[model samples]
Target chain A: MINTILCIILAILMISIGGKRGIKSFISLCLNFILLIFTFYLIACGFNSVIVTLLGTIMFSYFILFYVNGRNIKTKISFVSVIIVLILLTFFISLITYISKISGFGEESLEEINMFSYNVNINMTNITVSLILISLIGAIVDASIAISSALYEVYENNPNLNRYELFISGMNIGKSILGTTTNTLLFAYLAEFMTLIVWFNGLNSSFSYIINSKVFASEFIKIILVNIGSITIIPITAILTANKLKNTKE
Target chain B: MSKFSIQRKDIVIFTIILILSTISLVFVNNNFKFYTSTIVKINSIEEEKIDPITEPNILGIEEDYYLQKITGTIMNGKDKGKIISLENERSTSNVVDEKYKKGDYVFVSGNDITGLKRDVYIIIVIVIFIFLLFIIGKFKGLLSIVSVVFNTIIFCIGIKLYTNGLNIILLILIESIIFTIISLILTNGVNKNTLSAIISVIASMLVLSIMILLIAGITKYKNVNFNGMSFLTVPPEAIFTAELLIGGLGAIMDVCITITSSIKELIDKDNNIETRALIKSSRNIGKDIMGTMINVLFFTYLSGCLPIFVLSLRNGVSLTNYIQANFSLELTRFLVGSIGIVLAIPISSLISIKFYKRGDAR
Candidate 1:
């Protein structure tokens, strides 16, 4: 009941305050939510999670960039950069998950899931990589879009600037954005970690034990991976936007 | 300097980090002596049996399970260099059980395999992250890293006090203020703009807490499900509030600083700019930021719930029941967080204006 009320209230606020853009933001949120549920459904129904995540991320970036922010050079460049970064990140994430064997539910969740059968024939490693990818896509997309759009605006106002200068400007802009962006990502994950930390503290688990625990390690990895993706995209978006703007002007 | 020269410098940094990380990985893998439990380096594994569980469990799903006979030598502790044989069982899903291959390291006490030695992976990532921070942020990056480490330590200490019977809401409130002061000063430095942002964040957070309390009071927190946190021994209400206070602080701080800094830039650019124009410009900036921040939080909070959501749904829980059981908490977090982000915009603009005007007077 409270959930429905809160949703209604949030919806009303978004529409009223944001006006047209607000309504689109609200719609994008709903569409993305449904898409995620569908992705999980496919994975649960025995489809390849990695493949689903790939397709899902493509559609997600499309919704986030073209649908919410609109189609433009900025969105196009951001879309391209996001896809590129995600591809590179996929290889890195897969390698790490394979080596760490950090997939599957952790010991902390065993109490809640003790009654369920674990015989489902799915690669937990793949699922872990997929989860990490899903958790990170939003932040990456958000950061790239911010950079490309901000760079594009700079290009518009200073059309005489060369590609090299534009690239430097983008980096400067990225530097400013980087601090708060990472902090936002970090704290979001930390919030999720709080309960688990409390649970561990309650049990009086030693520092080494908690640090070495599967659950804590997995959560910490997810945070770092997202930060990496966001950071990498800054340079990529800057380069792409700068190159694109210069070519179009010529 | 040529662009190629800059590229060369980057290459050096990259190669050095790569070499250092490799060395650290070796050190961490071999440093199992630091552990209290005996660490085993699995040298060989023989599959004992592949058994299909015939019984449909609570979720009405069956799976193929495996049993392995593992032989390895102890790598650390008092039993160093002793051969040990252990039996392990893992299912295809491997929800809580790990599938060990030859050449894997595991912690063991006597005959039981306890857990995987994962510090090597953590150390590698941390090393790379710190380097990346240095590469991108330079001096500022170093400070931000320190602030993050400090904030994490402070958070742990706060949790310790909470477990020792401290009031969570009060504790987190104080911690939030401290975090804002320290992180803002560390990353942004001590300036009027930082001070303006600090005041703005506190103001918005104050309003946010009051708003949440009022809502919770009016609704009597009715239908606010605590099923997701059922294992917690403390009051879920208080813990959830603390989570909101701290979780929302990040986004609020982001919004506050962005507005505050942008306004400071505008004022610094044209010292005689009208207050009305400044207000309009900041609001426009705030609008763009608000949308993106909401989207970021939406996917972040919602994505974390997907695995558990799918797991529970497959376990035969209805969609409605699933939402009631697990998602309500996440939804509440997102909603309250979005409100905080939105609230920060006007509060920050108003505060920035006041602070800037005061500066003009001085």
Candidate 2:
């Protein structure tokens, strides 16, 4: 019932925004949503989530960068490059972090194991790795895109600007957005776990005990690792875009 | 003034908030109905069970389960400072449950049986979080903390409303809007750029929610089984919608603000830049941001659902059944929220274009 009311409000907002563009945006998003569902269905069919995620990332890039941005080759190249770099970065980081071993820290639903049939053999470790990889993809993509697009704009606005100048411009934009983007991640984590935090407070757990708790330790490590991944993307995207744009212009 | 002056001011503010928060903590602890207990001594330890299948432990003392008799002093409540005895259950799989040693403090209810062992830990974690935020973000950090407090209050109210039999979806939607407005205004201040971001955020949420409702309706809501969540009393659909609304709000707002502020910068750089060009620039920016924004939503949802994923997979559940039973809700949220993010790019860009074009014309 509330969904119907919100849809009405959305319709009014979309129409006011410009019926054509608004409708187009809505359709594009719907299609993207469908693609995501399709990816999961493929995973359910025994396909690897890592590969499915990569393919989905490629399709999503095509949709948002190429289709939505009117088939701009420059934007497409920048986005795809950043995604490639991000995937590589995540691979090496995950290897060193040993993030998978600790991934099973917060399984509160273990008591319900008997509820489901357990005949099929599935690799829990691989799935955990894939889950972490999938999680990092969003932040990496956001950072890379932010840097690449800002640099792209710098290049577009000033055809005569050199590589160094564009790189600096991208860095400046990145530095400003970094705080908020990181906060966005922080708050996102906090919002999800507020109740857990409240429960902890109600229990009056000490700081040492709280940090040592399996659930808290796991989430804390994830937040830190993701922040590192995001911060790394900024310079990599900036340099890559600067280099790409420089070569393209020449 | 200088940077040092600002640092000093921040430190002062942090100290004040810390004091106030500590005072409130004491007030809550004293006022609330809690049975406080402290560890006194270990009475005895006995092996209970090594394996459920085997009735006798042929291996003897090396058995898996151990029951410890822990005697403690009641620090508060009707049995204030009285000696008490409790059993602490320890298992080989310590990951599932913890064993408290001597000198530990715990909070027990009226029955004095079910008690939380580490109640003070969370308060320390929160204090550290606030301190770090203030040290890093300074004034903006302070404002972010305020915004978080407001959001928590609003969330509590929404939960109260839901429990009281109010329309959960409506409450969530209203809560989300209020949260977005307050967060934006606090973070970015009241300005044209913030307004554009706000509109974009609302538009994205609306689009995502509508699509989800349509899809849910079409599928007859088969995949959304909320039976697994033992705590839920309302319809699973409402809870699911509420989760999506709250889960997607942060990333959507993040994307919208990035696009809006970036476009605003471009316009300020060149006042006469055409609306067509401005819109193109914003879309380009959106493309760069879309992957990470979507991933942010994806990761947040994934992390929360990881335990269930692991539990199901470890139990040798079939991939298809696991996906159906455990992952459908998370997948719906991540995808629908991703769509909102994707749409927010264009919506924010277009809104900024209109705002900028009008400002330039005037």
Candidate 3:
């Protein structure tokens, strides 16, 4: 019921945004959703989570940037920069996941697992790691596109701006985006777990005890780790775009 | 000091509130009582055999599990600073039950002996999180922390009302509106930009709720399962709707602020710019942001569903069954929230255009 209503509403809103552009955005988002579900299916079918995630990230980066901005140099730059960041961030995400001992912290699902009554032979740790990695991709892609386009505009408006000036402009734009993006990520976790927090409080759990809970720690680590990726992309994308734009101008 | 030189006062007020809250949090006695125990030594470990008749396993036999004889010192309560011995069972699955080691802090209950409660690791993590936030955000970070504290109080009150049999949806709606206004004011101050963002958020929510209602009515609200969310007290549908409202608010607010502030900047830069040009530029900016803002909603909502997804897949459930059983709520939220963001772009753009034009008219 909600899906149908959402689809209709999205269709109307998309058309209103721009007849063709709106439709394109709607289709692109739908495809992205399908790709996500497909990625999970692949993972379940015994494909490696990391490889599937890499391929999925590349596909999503292309689809979102191309669909939104089209086949411009700006789109290409954002795509390449995002991929580079994703490659570098994957190792970091894995290291953090392993060190934190956050794998299989699904104690909340103990009841459901009992109800299902199935043999648990899967690597619960790998799924946890994959989910964390998957979560970072969206933020990284978003940051890359925002910085690349903002820098592109800065360079466009000021034709004579050199590489250094353009890079500085990109950094300034990135700095502004940092706070809200971080909040978006943090609040996202908060919103999902608001009830759990309330439950803990009602039970008289101390702030220390609540934060140290497996569920809470898993989420907190995920938020910080993903934000680290989002933050790193800013400098890397800025330098890459600045270099690209400068070279193209020459 | 000028009238606007209120930063020092704000800091002073914030500090006092922080100190008071911290003291109250630590010193106040909780309604439920627990014995604080400090692990002194792991005395011994032994394998306990379970009766095959009582406990059956996949191999048609009971599995042996380890039990540790743990000795600890009571740090608080009537047995303050007293040594005690407890058996820590190492269960077959470590996810459900945990094993304790020497020098670890644990909580225990019961008057006679004691039942083991959770460890005290979360407190350390919270301390680190707050310290990092303050160090990175400075004054702004301080304000954000204050806003979070206030918001949490509101949410707790809202939950209290709900458990007391108040309407959860209404409580959540009111709480969300209040949270939006208060947090924005605290962070951005009272201004035209804040007003525009607030208006945009409320307007988008109104439209989104109408869509939800229509959809709920049409579909008769089937497939809305609350099986996995066994923790909720109220009706599952009510909690789900309330969560949807609260879950979408942050992303929508973020979008609204970005669009409003960006458009405000453009209008300020060129006051004589045509309305058509302003709207067009706003749409362009919205296009640039819509992808990631929507992704923010998508990823965040999906993260919560990851556990369920893993559980279902591990159980060898089919894709369709997984979607029906696990992904339904998250899928609804992601779609509804994404649509809210989609609507927010134009809602914020159009409203800011009006606000700017009205300001110029004055």
Candidate 4:
């Protein structure tokens, strides 16, 4: 009952203020509800969450990206490439996590979580891998795709640009976009980790543990994923977005 | 562009980074142990003193403190099973809560319970963080802190409810909404523009949320192995919920800022431009902002986990296990959020175009 009331209030408020933002937000909200429901249902239905998750990401990404506006084929292709890159991210992150088996910082928060799963005899590796894969995903994919789309659209306006010339321009612009995208995550995470890192530092334990420990391990995974993910996404998106546009532009 | 060379400023920043890295290495050399405390008899009372080496057998590697094996209950977390022995004390960690007693579930990371002395380094970090935020954000930072405080209170309550094991999904939803409100209200304000920003943020967040659950369903990602986490602040369930909520917080703020600024820019420029123009400007604005937006997401996450990366490199953890175990859900949260920002450029463009169209039509 309370949930219904809350939902109603949220609906009214969203509608009242949603003026300039469009009802797309409403669509998003409903989709989110569905996501949650689907999550529950999948858990119950005994589906392989890994594949479900991939499909989910695609579905949501599609909604979030194209629901409000249309994109050309190149843009869609670029988006797909980002997904392809994401799949690689998943593979790499899981593989690393599974292999390293640092116990993720022995007694750290992750350890505690994994420990609970241990009691249940759950495969801690997969769970941790999924969590890790998704961490840097939002920002990474957002930045790359946006930049790719922008670069293509920008280049489309310049008919003098050949493929090579266009790639150079895109790289230059992509670098600029990449700079801030990096900082947003950098500062925010820095802001949150200020204390945690310092605490680690003060311990004056061998620097190795700070890096190798589970807590640090968890963070390391996030960074590497972002680095590899971003690096791969950029080139892939640039190539894909600019693909065949050589002729399209002239 | 100014000659895209390694400019003086770049050099200076690089040097600074080098310096910070060096300092970090010093920290690494020192093992990053900050807290300093040891379980001892009441000021040399000697009666309570036990074989320090017996406790925290792991302390053999700890350069920081003497071991003291003492049994106590963990006042918090899944380890509340019974009195557990504790030994090593690091500045970042603490001993069992005061109420901890033998036969009471307790897991110790620091020295004996009562949380021996805190490491001087942690205190320093706390002091530094406070000063930095206050200095940089000024009154707004203070407000941010207040916002954090208030949000934390709510988070506490939410977690408390979750600890009791209620509706995890509902809790996550409510928690996420509250977090969004708090984040927007704190950073932007309770104004129309803020509301617009919230809508933009919420919209993207909704998208990300959908993706998360959908993937969870499709991938059965939620069937996550719930091992090893029975010792944290809350049960695995609550922790997982909190993890998602907390993980999403930074991205929420990121999107909110991007949208808010873009809209503000649109409204400022004559407020009479074609929706198309407003959108173009928004995309331009997003274009300008994306660089720093994504950089911090990558860096912040990476920097926080710097030690882990370093450790992975040092210990030679296999590429596969390292990436899988090391990468966190928060990183995924960033990916999802960044995607929103990327997509938001077009979405905001469309909305702003319509925003103007509506005004002109009316």
- Which candidate should be chosen as best, given lDDT against the real structure? 1
Candidate 3 clashes between residue pairs 3 or more apart in a chain or in different chains? A208-B123, A211-B122, A212-B121, A212-B122
Once superposed on the true structure, which residue ranges of model 2 sit more than 4 Å away at CA?
A: A1-111, A114-179, A182-250, B1-7, B17-63, B78-83, B108-113
Model 2, B1-362: lDDT tens digits are: 01213566766887897897797567534432432343232233333443432222221212255565667676655666677777656554332434555555555444343333333434433555555555444566567657767876777666666666788668877887898898899888899888888888888778766766666666655645454443332345656656666766777788788888889889889978877788778766665556445546655565455445544544455657765666655556566565566667777788778877887777
Clashing pairs in 1: none
> What is the alpha-carbon lDDT of model 2 when measured against the actual structure?
0.60
Considering summed lDDT, which 10 consecutive residues are worst modelled in model 2 chain B?
Answer: B54-63
| Top TM-score prediction, candidate number | 1
Q: Candidate 3: which docking quality band?
A: acceptable
Candidate 1 lDDT:
0.81
DockQ score, prediction 1: 0.53
- Predicted candidate 4 versus true structure: per-residue lDDT over A27-51, tens digit per residue: 5545643563354234223245456
Rate residue A162 of model 2 by lDDT: 78
Q: Tell me the whole-model lDDT of each prediction, alpha carbons only.
A: 0.81, 0.60, 0.68, 0.47
**Model 1: number of clashes?**
0
Tens digits of per-residue lDDT, candidate 1, B1-362, equal: 11312566566766776787788878887788788878899999998557664465556677777898999999887779989999898887776788899988888876999888888889978887878776776556667778889999999999989888888888888998998898888878888889999999999999988877777667766777675676676667778777877779899999999999999989989999999999889877876877779878887787777667657666776777776767788888888888888888889999999999988898
The local lDDT score (0 to 100) that residue B296 gets in candidate 3 is 65
lDDT of 2 at A89: 54
Residue A231 of model 2 has an lDDT of: 60
Tell how far residue B237 is off in model 3, in angstroms: 1.6
DockQ category of candidate 4:
incorrect
Question: Predictions ranked by TM-score, top down?
Answer: 1, 3, 2, 4
